[model samples]
Target: MKRFQILFFTAFLFLCANLLFAQINAPSPIPDRVVLNLTENPATSVAITWRTDVSVSEGFCELQPAAEGPLKKEDSKTFKAKTTTIKYEYGDEPVIDANQHSFIFTDLIPGKKYIYRVGASDFWSEWFEYQTPSVENDKFSFIYFGDPQNDLKSQWSRVIRSAYRHAPDCGFMLYCGDLINRAGRDVEWHEWFHAGSFIYGMVPQVMTPGNHDYNDLMLDPHWNAQFTQPTNGPKGLEGTCFVIDYKNLRIISIDSAVDSELENENGYPMQAQKVWLDSVLQANTKKWVIVTTHLPFYSPKENRDNKHLRKHFQPILEKYKVDLVLSGHDHSYGRGRVSDNPQAGHKVMYVVSVSGPKMYEAGDKDWMEHSGADKQLYQLISIDGNELSYQSYTASGELFDEFILNK
Candidate 1:
């Protein structure tokens, strides 16, 4: 009896020791902050990114075609994820550290649904499905949000969820900028990811960095680490200023580092973007063209005019007859084309909106056709051939304003 008891105790201790070893080796290897970002060609490629604890040195993504019935793991192909360790220090906070992983799936069939998940080794995320944009010139839509900077989990989450409810089939989401209140604070980025939850994993993102996304107009290191963007911009600016030709429209993202107080050897980053924009617009073969950036070319509030932005970019946009100029930073909602005849909307439509809980009264409203304040709003823009339809909705899913432009 004594020998049998000794054996039982030894076995139990061995089992516990193995469990502890496993725990230490794989400490919270679960993937989090998973997001999908757009590549240059949405029809044939997509980029995905995620995060995990430092224990997960390596990561992977499993891809499978979507079909009816249960997913068969045997039918899926595994692709390794590139992982990088990110360490951040807040103003007076402890250092935040984690592993970020990213992968770009290329040569995909257009207009097809694909299932994927990301993780390392035995830990993985649940299967998420995303549809590719069709190259057949079919109608494509995307959701646009202004600034999701404050009260992310408590307030901004509802705005993103409401956008999902409205446009479940959106090809991708466009964030004008100011995604958080701080530049390099990991907690704010965590809240931004938590607010979107699984929605970000499915629909890809196209982002422009706002002032708050930078410290002293210097970009946060997290941007380059967490995102893999198009390298089509001119020298000195690659991911921040890029052009993606998605279906019938040519989408261009420009950086606002030159809007006010930023300087480099290249003279304020905007010069290169202007040259790139001119070339891209001159050679644009798509039926429509839209530009999205952080600061508005036309400010919607008093004493907030972006004179430099207007002086440098306005002529180029007018010369090419760009369809829309979407931007944030005013914290109020304003949409109108600056034309002599408001009825004859021959020029580009400029829109400025906000999605966070922050409120700012519009001191300038005479130039706004559809204006509102203290309302968190989202816009769904659809393009089918020559007609583009835009609908704006409040956080509670009420339609706030809308407009349609024909090319």
Candidate 2:
């Protein structure tokens, strides 16, 4: 009876211990992969998007100027700034259902270093720091890459890392759509983030949507969830389409998907965006006006010519005398001047290039002054007053093409 009792007690204790271990060993719902968007407005404001496994009913961020004391012992400049947080929520689902959150920190000082960290009820994120660009810099540079579609892990990572290694001091990074081949898959999005991890947190990123960025004949959940841009520009064209102003540069991004089939029959071209663009261009006394889209008006890619887009937006670009039009979806490089008469003043330069593993053959065309095929490239653009300098570099950081635009 004594042995039986002892054995029974031992079995009971063992079962309880196993149950406790199972409960304790369960995965913790912690916030992860916090990415700071350095592209939008980095000086006056910065945006951060992070993912969490558990739903956070309420959350906020704390920020302070990054200290350069230890790094520069000879030069001691103590920096301090008040921290602010902008609260937001997506869907009313429970914590387990909610996965992504984005917040914008505004009213920041340009050219100042700021340290920040996010906090939530279930879990708290680590502290990270970044510096805002100096608005006073007359000559500023940025990186432009397009279409990181297909083979994101092995091939695309090289291109992204190469660009970062070459231009570490770039003010911002512009990705002209198709960040991933399939947007619905969480793993692919993770790979996209992994490929661009080095620069994604450091530099500001402005992204446009490519056809592959979409899923199931609609906007992809991943793209929509990760980015936050100006939605107040046009009523119907919100996320996929918007406009942002940085220093003397006014960037206008449009959703080619909407205008691709010429389906918006209610004077679609002449209605909202046209009026808004006219007002923006006319009102914008900025030194440069840049338009970015996923689809190029003239691309060498098979079955990728956007005739309707050219007919609708080309006149507007000419009327506004836009400085440049950057695009991708061609998987090759093509640059041309949009003026029918060369002496009639440079209207706009339409450029298409790719920065992914995919390559396409370039077709011989009269409009194409510079063309490249069988290579992966990204563009580095420098704007100084009236002069705009552009250099196209291959994945290995070799200058493949170069040009200048004298405004």
lDDT value for candidate 2?
0.71
Off by over 4 Å in 1: 1-27, 258-268, 339-346
Candidate 1 global lDDT: 0.85
Where does candidate 2 have its weakest 10-residue lDDT segment? Answer: 80-89
- Give the candidate number with the greatest lDDT: 1
Q: What TM-score does model 1 achieve against the real structure? A: 0.89
Indicate the worst ten consecutive residues by lDDT in candidate 1. Answer: 257-266
List pairs with backbone clashes in candidate 1: none
Model 2 lDDT per residue over 218-330, tens place:
66666656666667467766666777777778888877755443346355533676677767778776779899888887776555677767666777777778988888888
Provide C-alpha RMSD values for all models, in order.
6.6, 7.2
- What is the C-alpha RMSD, rounded to one decimal, of candidate 2? 7.2
**Deviation (Å) of 7 in candidate 2:** 29
- Report lDDT (CA) for all predictions: 0.85, 0.71
